[model samples]
Target: MFSVWKISLLFMASLALTAATIPGKKDRRPLGGWTDVNVTENDSGLQKALEVAIREHNKASNDQFINVVTNVIRARRQIVAGMKYSLNVQIAKTDCRKSDSTPENCTESELSRLSQHKRCRFVVYLVPWLKKEELKQNNCD
Candidate 1:
């Protein structure tokens, strides 16, 4: 029969192995890295709004998808253009709530640890594109 200490050591080793096998949270990202899209010819307001929406969305959730709603609203209707734009943003899933908030106070090592969990998510909608034709529509094929 194995001694008491010998059995205890074996049990501990088995426990460690089991823990190691458990999967940890994955680092999620958009299909491609950060993408830059032209918001409009010279519409800074629309750009700011889009950035704000993305930041807020990240705060609500760290998932790898964004929900953009295209409905006619007062503010959205003002930005009339011959073309439309789309932006799919993704933020890291870390304990750090805000992108700016993390860089200021969190250390490299600390940030590395909190990146192993899942969180809530939300979406927003803006519509100013349905009226526009395709990019090459005006040009002959």
Candidate 2:
């Protein structure tokens, strides 16, 4: 007993509601326990991603910290859905500076590139969802 126009209107309203409910591409912070940094062609992007991951992990786990080992940064950009990053980061659980060293003021990026720190080598792979399995099998440790 409903007209075609009425049915179409109802369908459109339902579609609109569904679209509104779908989540946007939010900058989802890295999962709590492990920190993951995405490597991009641009150094700035890599640094930003690493910083975000570290911050996320620290926020989630107050008693633990992820320390970036500056000397060991190896990253490759992946060509997927345009361009994505695959960052190979070496991290430790302690801060980069030691308790005895001269307290030096350094930026996050600078700290990532520093050479002196206790190393607890653990590799984490980050890729676009599409290439996740391939990257994971090859990179994750």
Candidate 3:
């Protein structure tokens, strides 16, 4: 009787240990995707806008990330095409950072803000393009 009880207890302990070592299914996906924009320099204003939009989105019941894409489409009687824009967004629970060092690398205060507010961390991307002449024109501005 004593040997049987000891064997049962050992089996239960091993099973518990194995279960504790395995990761939960929900904890697996990557945090964010690459941005579509070719950013040569850091733009503070754009970053701020993204942060604000993300904060609002995550505060809602559904947690999702937003993706904005743009395309040029021809308009009637126009030599150039009009820009077409679309936003694709969805929410899923995800791990923001797997390691402790992420907070150190974040420039935007949004990460810290999310931590304090107990909100989901949202990922966003903005894409924009300009013709050569348009780029030259904007270069002077």
Q: Per-residue lDDT for 99 in model 3?
A: 38
Candidate 1 per-residue C-alpha lDDT over 11-95 given as tens digits, one digit per residue, 9 for 90 to 100: 9999999988866756433443332334444566445444445445534544443322222122231222332334333233434
Query: Residue 119, candidate 3: how far off, in angstroms?
Result: 19
Model 3: per-residue Cα lDDT over 1-141, one tens digit each: 569889999999999999998789866433342233323346443343334333444343243422111111111111223222111222222334323323223333333322322222233332234321111010000
Poorest 10 consecutive residues of model 2 by lDDT? 132-141
| Local distance difference test values of all predictions, in order | 0.39, 0.44, 0.33
Global local distance difference test of model 2: 0.44
Off by over 4 Å in 2: 1-42, 60-62, 81-83, 95-141
Off by over 4 Å in 3: 1-40, 63-93, 96-141
Which rank order by TM-score, best down to worst? 2, 1, 3
* lDDT of each residue in 40-59, candidate 2, tens digit only: 34466455444444444334
TM-score of each: 0.25, 0.32, 0.23
Number of the top lDDT candidate: 2
Residue 118, model 2: lDDT of 43
Q: Flag regions of model 1 displaced more than 4 Å.
A: 1-36, 39-47, 62-78, 81-85, 97-141
User: lDDT rank, highest first?
Assistant: 2, 1, 3
Error of 2 at 70 (Å): 3.3
